[model samples]
Target: MKTLLYIVLVLISFSVTAQKPVVNSAKLEEIKSYLKHFEDNDALLGSVSVFENDKELLNQSFGAIPASRTTKYQVGSISKMFTAVLIGQLVEEHKMDLNEPLATYFPKMPGASSIKLSNLLNHTSGLQNFVVKQDSLKYWLKKPVSQQAILDEIARQGVAFQPGDSISYSNSGYYLLTRILEQKYKKPYETILEERITRPFGLENTFSLNGKTEYEDTAISYEKKDNKWVKLEEFYFPNVQGVGDIISTLSDLNSFMSALFNNEILKEETLKRMLPKDDDWFGLGIMKAPFYNHIAYGHGGDTYGTHTVTSYHPESKLGITYVINGEGYPTNNFAIGLLSIIYDKDYSLPELTEYTPDKLYYDAYTGTYSSPELPIAITVYQKEGALMAQGEGQSPFTLTPKSKHTFAYLKAGIHITFDPDAETFLFKQGGQQFELKKK
Candidate 1:
């Protein structure tokens, strides 16, 4: 009995020492399959980087060649994180005040008195996202707007809300940051990034790609179609400046976030200030969104033929930088899903159950369903003995049944709640509700 106990103790010790947290290779393969599926379905052409404890478990470039790791992707609004870090570094140097009004710097805007630098960083400034309002690419290309021009746009447009009132993302706000940084430092935004963030971190492959020269090993952007791919001409928007204008690779982005959370860049106190507050996710310049027990600080970018997200959690010290050549490719959702899978969280995806609704019922719902939020009413129809709904300005997808009265739209991650009110039915997708009478 003594001998058996000793042997068991030795075995237990060996097991404990040998055990290490590992990414399930099979799960990684499954993730790879999902990426291929996205490429097949969404026509995605991009790269993904997932790491745990600074170790890369999955690194795969999916789809066609133009936009791979070797190729630089215009990482859209993700540049905001860099701008945030620059601001953080400046704050550390005691060169800039976070709570000061913008008027202190440019002092030219219409209602500069109402706008604060912190508000601009956090998107609470209520300033319009000028990119949304104007023909961003055309105007920017015609005569690349300067930092002063961006400030003038904000000043001309005036405040969207009182300082510190609410959170609304504004590219103009970050553009203003670029202006303020330039005004204070006497250098362009690109120079500031090179000096402050990229150089200090030793990111050789990372830098702003503003159409000055075609970068070597940079991925080409593409649009996917019926089992094929279409090349997209990339455009530049210098007006967005530091807001949406940035180019980098998945690997370099991963390095940036790792160094950022590891305290290689800003001090811990400055990082704390740079992070978001309780019940609020926007911080000095980064976005703080909750994921499991930890919070993720990062940003996503969207531009023509490209979508990207880079995020990291301080507690786990894990970061992810994902890029796609397709706009609105659900990069954030995929990032969160990837994390959930890694942690073995209970994740539920809407399943496409074999649903067969009454032909008459399908006919009743088949008319063009209109909503103010949607440019076109969703058209429901019976095809191949299955009911499907085609959303306006969206890809056509089938409606799978969650119940006799409710149906979930695949790919769109939305459910159509049918409220039968006599001859009429009300459809609810998210906060938007629409009423459609049987026609």
Candidate 2:
């Protein structure tokens, strides 16, 4: 969720202006069939909700019992959108300023004197994301982490560049923003969220997580391994508060987006500042997603296991949110296909298939590849009659072949298509692409 909808493929346009509304009974049936396909095939494994002018067009659950429609999956970085709105509220109340220095609240934080609230909101703070470098964090992330310990760790991770120098996704920035909200409101983040956003918006199902691991109607996220669905671990909920700790069902997410677009959360002028102005990659907590020529503004989120996306189209007043706990197909592909059907674009239902290991020589793909775009080199190799890949500073993972030269590790959201003749492969993840040549 560090990068929301940076989709390299099929993201052909970039206009946020309102477009003509497109809806029909046939398209509604198509949408039903489109979603049912995932449920029947077990391609997408969570919940989906779509809205038009505050009317629920679709609300459904996949890959679980009928009661799972109420399951509240952790929405990860989409919580950033909520946090940004809180900041916006405080600014309107004169409790904070967009250009105010972080030092005003957390004097000990590194670069607190230079980093502005706006910098953090737009991801130009340059703060080293404390939760990054998972190799080191994984050892302790599953356990409880204290607020003081978190602040200390943020200080230790320190700055990567001067504040406002460049853009980088920083959970530390949002975590601190959460803390600032608490300081400003003199209340816990959960209480602040309830008083300001959830209760006021009547989003009864949305909540900020603390220590409770077992909640009614909340399914644990998962991944497929050894031909069976297996539970996937997530970050300690409290540690990622106001960054990735909020949990909500698709219904509530749909409502939140609709309420937001209605200007209940912030005034139209303030909302404009939070939207992409001119050519900005992101506006405050928002990101733009494209559906052919239509544009929707919102954010995406990922925890260790779950992935979520939420957006609202101002022109049509359409809101869509998809949350995936696991998938046999890349959630992005399913999302693209779903949107195509919604916009009445030419699209085909995806064929979900399980691959059998092929006898093609894995040796041809074994080598070290370096990309100028990435700091780490990826080393491909063979292990136990299976193809494998390891990025520098990351654990090795088995690759599932889509074709003789195309493979992916779905759990990690990585895909690599090889060109053995040219000794190159294209790498895609979190919607960014890079072409690397074998060394």
Candidate 3:
């Protein structure tokens, strides 16, 4: 009996030793330095929070806004994860089933009778993304849309494919789910969210905007125009309810994600349903996003000028959440840089010096250029004294001059070096270079 007791004590000791706390102040400083590079260059304007095992490692806010832990920003589609959790709660109580057809709640929808709840959650309903249509902005931007009007707009598009035949993202599906939730509980989505998730989790800075909620300390979103920050809330915030209207802080998002992953807010089986498995990158609302060597689970959000990402690595017990009210640089790069720092991996910071080329240089490079290796032709033009390049079927992007003949598109990681004498340019991207001749 004594030997058995000794064996048990040894196992407990090993377990305790295995759960050692992680601390690396140097690595944390590296993350801070990387963020500062973006802030100094006017590339990022927002807040970031990182936690390991629910312990805060870094919490910082940058830019013109007096951002704090309580400052809320519209999290866009990150709200979908919260909606998924509410659905999970209803499923646990036997109030709803994932396999139930949408027709049960939204029979007026064209394909509602065939689309299942799971299809909406996993983005397989094949419902047309109504918001992407040109007419949608004209209708929703100027005024608040009634629930019926939103439904009518979705119905007008009909299904792009048969239900569950394939996967395509549809905000309309989430909108319908929101209406179904309202019907099931006979309560406003705001009240449902407050009672079900925010209040229970003690998330004081998280709330939904239904155009009536009096919210304070919200971040003002901005876009860069002619090297200036232009506020966009006046033109953008309407008609985003249910689909992308929840406002939250970085700390609160981290807390909510940590609670959900820790099984404090969801049953084990329900949480599993939300996480990606079986070769599927998306599960319910949460999706699998790989960061370096870690497989992180979370969702990214974009609405107007705001961009946000919330991800957690279950194996590492790490959570990173950030919200950018003004983004001129790619947010994914920031996520990669932060995670690389935490894992002690090599990463490079952005070089922020700006260079301007003369009009003669622009004139020499202006023309249509194509390469035998590339599938599309690139048209180079000058816009407001700035060099711009547009590829076939893609929008125009401004090129930042890195040298006399070299230009870079930092967001896309493409570099171009012009050869004025040869009337050609070398296009370098993804570590591969191809020479294109002027046509």
Candidate 4:
């Protein structure tokens, strides 16, 4: 009797240990504190949800008007992942081929004969991003654009590079993919998305932005103006269409990601094809990024006044997602901090400080800086009383001074430390450092 009783107790202990949550109260409190810091400073206005397997570890919102889990927000480029999954389903059903040329659908498209479906999925099709071009933006933002208008814009331009030659992010590629889907299915892209992906998964809050004048329960987007939140004017959603027009909630997105990785939406083989090894670190529409020592796969998005990132680690069965309707800080830092705490890694809470540097001191750092190891030269100059840095082929970005010699570009996660005595600057981003000399 004594031996049997001991055996029963041991089994109960094992069961309790096995079912223990991966994250602890201490870590969760730390995460909450970190988010609250941003909220207190008016830098974060959003919702975050982190899940460990089937258990939700954190689901909280911050701001004057907090958003709930069901509140819809425009996910921007993350919509590409949904489009990619649709293509994957078609491929699984043998209705589509990844290696097929886009010319099969739109032969009139410039260089369509050479651009493969894979090229578009991985952003290597050499197509110019119509949304980024000044003239195209001027036209599209003014009114709702038809599919033909977008196609015409794409056709008017030459290929940026040979298809599959190199990787360049092109919204044009995904927009064209949307048209191909419609042509193949003989239905609108939204209809196809509903029939093929969202409906089957029971994703209620995930849908295309069609025939919707206003989104219900959606957070109002804001931009910081004179240190106050200012709502932005609405743009034509249809202009982005399949590229970046999907609206979803945190819960729905988490459900979709969970279903996708669990083989509920795709076959193992089809999923493998979507995760190709590429120079751009993007496979299909998903991006693979490193978190601590583990690799997480997902996509980030930015639109108007919204920023979002959703990623999952297969090894740990952890899914992390956040959407900010207003951002005055780097969104990536919040992601890094959340993931670090989830993994029981060391993460520093954000130190929010506003700096006003003297114009003379800022001007001293204004010059062109180049590194032999890096291909691009960075130009530093003053813009509107702020120090700005611009790399070749990139737009100018304001640098926030962390100290007299240390400056940071929050959006890019770049930190630059100047060595006035040595006349050099150390550029740091993503754990890599490059030394640049002033020219």
For model 4, residues 191-220, the per-residue Cα lDDT tens digits are: 998998889888888888875656688766
Tens digits of per-residue lDDT, candidate 3, 1-439, equal 0000000000011222223225478777777787788878877788889888887788988865568878898888887888888989999999999999998988888888889999999888988665555463533543566666767888998888998788777788887888788899999888999999999998999988877666889887786655667886532333655667888889899999899999999999889978878667779988887643456788877776677888887887888888778867665666666666665557788676777666687899999999999999999998898889999889788888888899888656789999988999999986899999999
Better of 3 and 4 by lDDT: 3
Tens digit per residue, CA lDDT, model 1, 1-439: 0000000000011222222224668778867876676555443567888777876777788764534455677777777788888887777788888878878976776557778788888878877655543443333433455555656566666666777777777777777788788888998787888888888788887776454656677655566432245676654556566777677878788888888777889887788777878867567777765554545677667666677777776666667777767532344455555555655555554232435554556655565666554456677776776667776676676666667657765334556755444544456654666665443
TM-score of 3: 0.85
- TM-score, one value per model: 0.74, 0.83, 0.85, 0.77
Q: Total clashing residue pairs per candidate? A: 11, 0, 0, 0
- The per-model lDDT (C-alpha) reads 0.65, 0.80, 0.78, 0.76
Q: How far is candidate 2 from the true structure (C-alpha RMSD, Å)?
A: 4.6
Let me know the TM-score candidate 2 reaches against the reference structure.
Answer: 0.83
Would you give me the overall lDDT of model 3? Answer: 0.78
lDDT value for candidate 1?
0.65
Best by TM-score: 3
- For model 1, give the 10-residue run with minimal summed lDDT: 1-10
Tell me the lDDT of model 3 at 1. Answer: 5
Residue clash pairs of candidate 3: none
Q: Give the per-residue lDDT digits (tens) of candidate 2, residues 188-247.
A: 999999999999988887889878645677767787754457888778888888988899
